[model samples]
Structures are given as C-alpha cells and as structure tokens.
Target: MKNLNKLYILLFAVLVFATSCEDLTEINEDPNRPTEVPVEYLLTSAERQLGNRLYGGFDNVAFGMTVSQYWAQNEYSDETRYQFRANTNNTFWSDFYTAINDLQEIKKVNTTIDKGQQGINQNAVATILQSWAYHSMVDIYGDIPFEEALQGVDIPSPAYSDQELIYSALIDSVSSAVAAIDPSAPGFPGGDVIFDGDLSKWQKFGNSLLLRIGIRLSDVNPSLAEQTISAAAEGAMKSNADNAAIQYITAQPNVNPLYVSYVVNGRQDYCATENFIELLNGLGDPRIGEYFVPAANTGTFEGLPYGVTSAVAAGISRDAVSQLNPQVYAADFPGTLMGFVETSFILAEAASNGWIGGSAADYYAQAITASMNYWNITDGNAIGDYIAANPYTEDNLKVQKYIAMYYEGWQSWAEIRRLDLESLPAANLVEIDPAVNFVDVSNILNRRLYPQDEQNLNGANYQNAASNIGSDAYDTNLFWDLD
Candidate 1:
C-alpha cells in the first residue's frame, strides 16, 4: 500500500510539470507583437523604401545627379569626378532589392488570403511597382537577376538574365498587371499612398511604364519595341493628374530627401553644373529660377564647373554658384516615380521612331509644354515662346527632353546614353575643363559596375555575368545601347 501511494504521487507530479511547461510556452507569445504584418502595411513600407532611395540624398546625388551632371559636388567632388563611393553603390543595389522583396511579399500575401477583386487590385499594384523597380535597375546595371531575384535561401545566387529577356518579361508582366486591375474594387483602403487605391491611375502608370520599357528596346529589339509601344500609347498617362508620385509630409521619417540632405543636415555640398545652368540660360528658360537659387554673393545664377578637382572646387565660393532651390528641398515636395511629362517625351520619341501613330512634332510640343507646366512656369507666353524657338527637330527633341528631365538623374542618364547624345554639341559630353580630365574615359558613364558584394558573396555567378557583359567596365554599353 505504501509503494502504491508513492508511485501515484510521482505520476501526479509529472503531470503537473508537463502542464506547467505547456503554459510557459503559451506565455512566450506576446499579443502586442505580431509574427506577420498585414499586406497593406507591407505596401506602405515598400513604397516608402523605394521613395527614399530614389529621391533621397545619398544615392540620388552621389550616383544619379552627379553621374548625369545635373548637380556637381561642391566640396568632395570625388563623385562628381566619376569616383562613386563603394558604400553608396552597395546601398543603391541592396535597397532596391529589398524594396522589390517587400513588393513580392505583398503579392504573395494578397494572392493567398483574398482571392476576390481587392486581392486582384492589390496584386496588380505590387506587380507594377516591382516592374518599375526592376526597370530602373536594369537600366542602370544592364542585366540583373529578375525571375529568381527574391527567392532568399532557395536561390542564393541568381543568374543574371539577359537584358533583352528581362525587357520582354517586364513588358508582359506590366501588361498583365494593367489588365488585372479591377477599377470597381476598393484596393488597400489605407496604405495606397501613391494613388489612394485608384485602380485607373495605377493602370495608366502601368501602361506608361510599358511604353518606357518598350522604347528602351528600340535599338536592340525593334519589332518587340514597336509592338509594345503601339499597344501602350493609348493607355498611358493623360495628364499630370495621373502622375505616379508620393507626397512627403513635414514629419520625422517622411520629410523630402532633399530637405534632409541640405537643410536638416546643413550641408552645402552640391551646386548646379555649369553645363546645365548655361544651357538653361542660353535657351531663355523661365524655370531656371525654379530649379536653382541665385548666388548670394553675386546675386546671379552662376554654376560650379563640372568634374573639377576638390582643390579647384574649394577655391569656388559656396555663395557664388547657384544651389538647388529651396522649393525643391521643401519638406512637402513630392517624389515623382513617373509622371506625365516623362510619358509625353517617351511618346514623342516613339512617334519619332515610327513605332506609334502620332505626329512627333505635336508630341514634342506637348512634352515641352508639360515640362514647363510641371515646373510651375505660370507664364503661358514664356512656354509658347520657348517651344516655338526650339522646334521639333530630332536634335531638338533629345535636347529638350534632357532639359525637361532635370532633377530626374537616372532617367536623364539613361536617355542620354540611349540616344547617343554624346556627339551632339548641346550634350556637352566633352570635358569642360580640358586641362583637368577627371574621368579615365572620354565619354560619359554608360553603366554602373555591379556592387562589390555581388562579387564577394556570389562569386561564380558574378564572374559569369561580368564576363558575359564584356568586362563590366563603366564605359561598357548596355545590350540596348547600340550606340
């Protein structure tokens, strides 16, 4: 009887301990912290991430503005001289991929949870944004890992797809996304910052992006370009109202990137390039004042010489050269991902190339008008006068597009290379200061070299891509860049 009692008590104690362990496990899960976030939150995060990188100070000025010669470094001058920082390059490469991954997650979550019209719309928006980010990446770095990029551990080293193949996939994806959007459905009621869940606007943006992508393949794959451009032209953005942009707020994490780079950081590190400002001045452009401020010292719009040595740059007075206008860096300024002005210019180019059914001259005039209006050049007379003076010749079309694309450094650089504008006198591709040749190459940058991390982490794939891309030199033209 004693042994029986002891055995029973031991069994009861064992059961109690097991119950306590289960209770402890349950307590570990805090209700305040969620393992998974809603898809809408993911959308906002992905958009914000891309917005900051695209328009923010570091990558924006270092790689895009400086390389394109829109804005030169006022102090360091290294990036302006084409010596891009390794960290800047790495951040640009990684940040874009990170945003793309987030967008991919949104698509997956929406597809699984909501199979209804709302899910369809959400998926479409995510697809379009993914394409936009990929397009920009391909344009800058030539070939990139597209289909297999965001697979995490499953595919640690994604092989770089051919640029031609990537373009085809992007066109098809964008078209499908546009078709999938249900205008009647309410999409992301809370997190749709770009268009406020407006499916129609998203459709227009998708089509416009399609047009842009198609135009890029004009030289490499003319048949596909023509087909894609013709189909996209009808559905592209109709006005500035359809612009795919995000307006920042005057708050902690949402301030305009320019404001953070200039005002918040209190850095006087950038100024207008002599080439860009002089071109605007000679054209009698009204937006010069809108684009830059008059030098405080001279009370005139002077520009710092492009690609000069830091020693030479140090000699120049900060108050002597025009700085970016305060309006540009204002906290409430909008970061444009794509807008009507760009679509108009793309249409003009497509029409000029005989890929679309429109008068090239008419499209060109509209593009110029749109650009002036975008800059808030209130004087209609000034816009008309400028357009009339610079008619729709092929050369004029490229030059006007370059000017209109001010502050849009990546697009400007891509266009300049795509059109082979280096030969044009107005492009001012040759060194301004012949005595000081900053870059090793005579021509402007063609493509950015792949991030060093790629070489280190994904060695075999990186080696193959670099080898296939003809040495990965900065001057190596992309597959689309026949020139």
Candidate 2:
C-alpha cells in the first residue's frame, strides 16, 4: 500500500512468470499464477519490505528470539542450555529466503551494469540487500545456502556454503555494490521510497555497514578490520540523515516491534532487563529519560541493577518490577534495529582501532552523541560535559555503546556475548550475582537456542547444526564471538 518506489515485488512476479510460463502456466490455465508486473511495482514493494525487514523481520525474530535477546532481556532472566539449544523460533531461515527471493528478482530486473545510473543504483541496493540477507542466514545458522540460494523453484534443496566464506563474500559484495552508487547523477526516484532516491544516502548507508563489518572482524582479524574501515570511509554515513532506515507508523501493521511487545495487550510478553535500566540510571545518561517512564509517584526515577534481588529492589512497588518498565516501552515502536546510532557505534569502535580518519575518543564521543541525538535528547552541552568529564577507556566505550544499543536487541546481545558479558565500570552499579535467588525468577540468561520450526522443516540440517554447538549455557560462544 505504501510503496516508496517499492519495486522488489514486481520484479519477483516477472521472474516467476517467465520461469513458469512454459510448464506451470500451461497446466494452471487460470492465468494469474505466473504474471509480469511492472518493474515500478516490484521496486515499491522492495522498498516497503526493506523497511519492514529492518525492524525485527522474520529473520530477526528467528535469530533474536532464539538467542534470548527477545525474551531474556524483557524477562530480566537467563537461559538454560536446553532453552537455547532447541528454541522453537528457528523458522527464520525460511523467512530469510522469502526476503532473498524478493531481492533477487529486483536485481534481475536491473540487469544492466551501468554505474551511476538509476537502474544500476537500484540493482546495487538489491545486491547489498542480498548480501545482508545471506550474511544473516549464515550468521544465524553457521553454514547455509549462499551461491545457490534464492533460485526458489530452480533448486529446491540448494547445498549450503561455509559460514566463513559466506561472510567473506558478503564483506566484498557490500563494499563493491554499495560503492557503485554514484552520488552525482540524475536518477529515477520511484524505487527508492526509503531515501527518496538519494544515491549519496545509499552510499553512506553502505559505508556505515562496511564499518560494521570492520568492527565485526576486530577481534578475529585486526588487519582485516583495518582494511575494511579504510575502504568504508570513502562513503560512510557522516550524519544521521544518511542513515539507511525508515520510520514505522505507530498505527496499524507498521508498529515498532517493541511497541507491540510493551503493549499491555496480550501481543507482548516481555519486559526490560534490570541490568539495562540500572546501568543507564547510574551513568546519569540523559537518554534514560527518553527511554523509559519511571514508577508513578516513586518521588524519583530509579532502575534496579542487572539481576535484581528483592532485597536490592529498593523502594519501588513489586508490580512495577515484574512488568515492562513503562518508562521505556511506549505504545509505538519508534525504536530502531539498525540506524545511524548503530553505525556510529561501529565507526567508534573502528576509529578506536585507528582504522579510519579520526581519533577513537572522538568517534566514541560522537557515537554517544549520535545515540542521544537520535533519541531526540538534544542538550548538546549536557552530552559534551559528560564526554569531557568522563575518562575514555575501551571498556566504558563499549559499555556506553552497549547501553545505547539496548533497543536494538540483536546488536546489544551480540556485543555482550563478544565481550564475555563483563559489566564495564562505566556505570556505578553493584556486582551481578551468578546465583540470583529472587522471587518469580528462574535462571541466569545466556544464548538463544536453535528454534523449533527448523526441526519440522529443515529437520536433519537443524539437528546437525545443534550438535556442533557446545553445552554450557553461559560459556558457549559463536564462531566470531569466541573469547
């Protein structure tokens, strides 16, 4: 309905028709099965769906939900080895294929390879999206269909690829295709509902993501991180406007994921982690005001530390503790899964490694600044004072970044896992007890397990992947998240 040059779907229909016209169309002579749709219509759907996918897509729910990023953070609890191992939400791989299929159709429509041209930009976005979709598939499933993916009816059970190779290809494709966007050219704008066909913004988004890739390999391959950052800086998102994102409507099907969750209505079943609130409150970070609404008539706003015990529950009423912090979960999901704030944090980490053209400290400061600004917390002096007065350290740097990324469940979850769940001294908070014996609490949180649908659909593959994972709930690490 809301097509910002949403052309992905039209292209998909065309491919479907052309491929099935001979065989399928002959049998099912009703005439609507395989049909050619306008390229414009396909692009509009692509743009529209991209916005949808960015905010907790099926792939996201599959990965994030399985990983405890979805419930544990909301429940303020931990995962058992079993809970994380055979999670029921593993149906995301199928959903990702759904996205890939749409994106590939869009790419096929723009078969031309003219750089700086409208068709090329459209194709480039599709390429970048394909790389992201594929990267996510492997990131969640370890090794998955890469080269032979999205052929749909072409290849039913495509062979999987190595995770490392998939990621490596993703890194290359993203940089190359994104860099292909020509900022200084007249372009068609219909297929670009997200950015109004602004090629420069597309370039910025690509670069911002490249910075993300650079930081992802920071621990695993430092030299690779350096090289990725150096190249990404060529067109990185310098300002918030360049962020590759779309604002969701508070109304209807476009509601934010968190917005739907925090609803008192049965649609949501999670709450904020005490760990998140206490850290934000302790740092006196202004974003907290923007994030949550504190207990009514408490006389002051306060958040319990990570892993709260009733004894340390402070003076708040019991009801508030067991529920989603009202201060944070608005009726709307204005929160972002990916955006300038996320990219800026990635850049901060990259800059800290001296990978790009700025001081680590400056980038870190700006990262926090972007977080605040994105949240509409515009007191520049307050943030400036916080940066000037506070000492910069690698730990605190990541801590603030961690706090800023709270709304982005997967990113924060990934960061904490990468950093060994060590709580930085950046915030003044008490120690987290491994043995938390609190009322209504079950266990300490850890990784999300493989989801259930995987068993029913990709049963054998899921079983094999699960066997390769370790047994420890709190200690297990992904290939890239290894200590």
Candidate 3:
C-alpha cells in the first residue's frame, strides 16, 4: 500500500511539471493582442486608410486642393506656392505602401486557408484596392518600388520600376481582379466598410477605377487607352448607388478628416482660392455655395489669393475669406474613393477621344447631372439648365470635370497636370513676387519629390531612380503627363 502511494505522488509531480512546461512555451502568446487576424479586419483598415488619405488632410487639402488651386492658404500660403512639407511626402508614401502591404497579406491569407470561391472574391477585392493604391503612388512619385515591393528583407532595397511599366501591370491587375470577382459568392465575411460585403459593387468600382486608369494613358498610349476604356465602360459605375465611398459616422477615430481638420482641430488655415471663386461666379455655378462658406466678417463668398507671398496671405483676414462649407466638414460627409460622377466624366472624355461609342455631349450632361444629384441639387429644371449652359466642347468637358472634382483633390490635381489646364490656375502664376521668399509656382508640381527616407535608407536605389528620372525635382513629369 505504501509503495502504491509513492508511485501516485511521482505521477502527480510529473503531470505538474509537464503542465508548467506547456505554459512556459505559450508565454509569448497573448490572446488579446493577436499576431494573426481575419482578412475582414485588414479589409476594413485598408479601405479606411485609402479613403482618408486620398480624400482629406495633407494629401487632399494641402497638396491636392491647394496645388490644384481649388483652395488656398489664408495665412501660410507656402503649400499653394508649391512648397509642400517633406514629411508629408514621406507620410503619403508610407500610407500607400502600408495599405498595399496589408492588402497583399489578405491575398496571401485567402490563398492559404479559404481557397474557395469566397476566397477568390476576397482576393479579387484586395487586388483591386492594391492596384488603386499603386496607381495613386505612381501618379504622385512618377517611378516607385513595385514588383519587388512588400518582399520584406528579401529585397529591402527594391529598385524603382518605371511608371509606364507600373501602369501596364496595374492595368493587368485590375482586369484580372474584375474577371476573378464572383459577385454571387460570399465576400469578406464582414468588415467591408466601403460596400458592406457587396461584391457586385466592388466589381463596378474596379471597372470604374480601370476606366480612370485607361483615360490617364490617353496622352501617352492612345491605342491602349481606347481598348481599356472601351472594355471598362461596359461595367463601370452606372449611378450614385454604385459609388465607392466610405460614409464616415459620427464616431471617435472614424470621423471624416475634414471634420477633424476644420471642426475638432478648429483650424482656419484654408480658404477658397480667388481663382476658384471667380470661376464659380463667372459661371453662376450653384456648387460654389455647396463648396465654400460665406466670409465670417463680410458675409460674402470672398476668396484668398492663391500662390501669393506669406506676407500677402497674412494681410488677408481669415474672416474676410470664404472657408470650406460646413456640409463638407460635417462629421458624416462621405469620403469618395470613386463615384458615378467621376466615371461619367471619364466616359465623356473617352467618348470625346473617339475611344468609345457614346455621345460625348450626353455623357457630359450625365456627368453634370450626377454631380448635381450627388450634391443634393435634384431640381429637374436646375439640372437641365446647368447641363445646357455647359455644352460638350473638349475644353468645356475638362473644365466641368475639374469643377466636379472639388473635394477629390488628388484626382483634380492629376487632371490639372494631365490636361495642363492653364485656364484653371490663371496662367499658373510664376514665382509670385520673386523679391520675397518665393516658391516657384510657374510650373504646377509635375511630380512630388521622392521621400527623404528613401534617400537615407534606400540610398543606392534612390540615386538610380533620381538619375533615371532626370532629377527628382517637382518639374520632373510622369510619362503620362507628357504632351
């Protein structure tokens, strides 16, 4: 009996020792802070990041709106003068790649575990978003680390791919994404913040994005442009219902950046540009009221002079200049990634370019109609009258497109650069008062400077890119920007 008791004690001690070893092995693991997560969480993050970065804050307000001359600084007018923050370039580059890397991971995850039609749909969605992010990066930086990007330590110093090559790949990627999308299948399980698990809308958004991408090559590769645009228009966003936008709710950490910038932060740094206000007033455009608020002191829709000296900007009272409209800075304003209004304009341009079989005038009218409807201007008479007044000349279509791209600063800036729209910036104001600390606004920023971090960390590759692109200056134009 004593021998039996000794054996039992020994077994119990062994069991305890085994349990302690198991616990020690799992000491690094934390259930609350998981290393691996469902792809749904990643989708939500990537979509949100893309929407915010493209639609507002430094990318939109300072770089896009100011550079596009839609808005100008009321006090510090340096950004309007083409003197952008270096850190912003770094942040913008990082923001895009981070979202893109997350998207790539989603694709990887889908391939590994959920290898079914649902997984295919998820992967397709990821590919479309990745293409969009890459397209934006190439559009801004001209040449960027693609192909080899997101390879981790395998290729830490990835070579910058030519913008032309990058665009070609993006075109293929978008096409594949569209084809792969099975709208009938379950998508993303949950956390699809943009369209709420609607794969059909995702397909349409992809095609619309593809359409925009094709139109961008109109100047550089017309044949490819025609072919791609023709194919994409067949499946592009048909109405406001199909628009790809992130509708921000009145919640902490998820509110629209415009609200955070103008309301929460209580910043009065920006005002409507004199050029923009003049354009609106000249046309009697109703969107003027939709876009800007009346001057605080004057109660008139006055504008601040764009690209002027800081001294000149400081002289203008903040209360005397029109700030962005309240509705724009409202908590619930949708941050549009791509919309029917934009796709309509793209179709119009394609039609005008003889790339597609549609009436340019009709498409142009539809674009204006879409824009009006989007802004809650639903009167039939008002819509008809506006469309009629703005006919379908090439210049008219481009100008109207510019007008419609009010809040989407990046797209506006891209259009401004692509079309070289001299009319919008009023002679593209050359080095305003050269005697003062001047930023050369003569040539609207052709391309953003490469991130300073790239130079420091990826020095050799950065040097090669700068050399290959013929200097990393703002004057360096992307391949598509060439006439």
Best candidate according to TM-score = 1
TM-score of each: 0.95, 0.76, 0.93
Per-residue CA lDDT of candidate 1, range 156-203, in tens?
A: 999988777888889999999999888987778778778877889999
User: What is the C-alpha lDDT profile of model 3 across 1-483, one tens digit per residue?
Assistant: 999999999999999999999998799688798888789999999988887787667888888888778888888778877777889878878888999999999988877685689888998999998898899888888889998899998998999998899889998999999999988888887898889999999999999999989989998899999888999899999999998988798996888888898889988588898878888887878888889988889887888877788889899888888988889888889888889988999998888878888898999999999998888889989889877887788878878888998888888888888887864443232334444534444756788889999999999999999988888887888899884
lDDT of 1 at 345: 87
Report, for all candidates in order, the number of backbone clashes.
Answer: 0, 31, 0
Q: List the candidates ranked by lDDT, beginning with the highest.
A: 1, 3, 2
Residue-by-residue lDDT tens digits, candidate 2, 1-483 = 558446777888888889888777578766674465445566556544544444442323323532323222223233211222243244344555675777777667566444347677776777765665565544444656677666667866555565666667878888888767776765445655556677777677777767776676778778887888888876777777666655555576656554554463444433334555666666777776565556444634444334443344433353353344453444454434257777766766777666777777877787788878877878889989877765567777767776777555556656665665454454332334446632222332334444456446666655555555543133445567766
lDDT score, candidate 2, position 243: 64
Better of 2 and 3 by lDDT: 3
Assess candidate 1 and give its TM-score to the true structure.
0.95
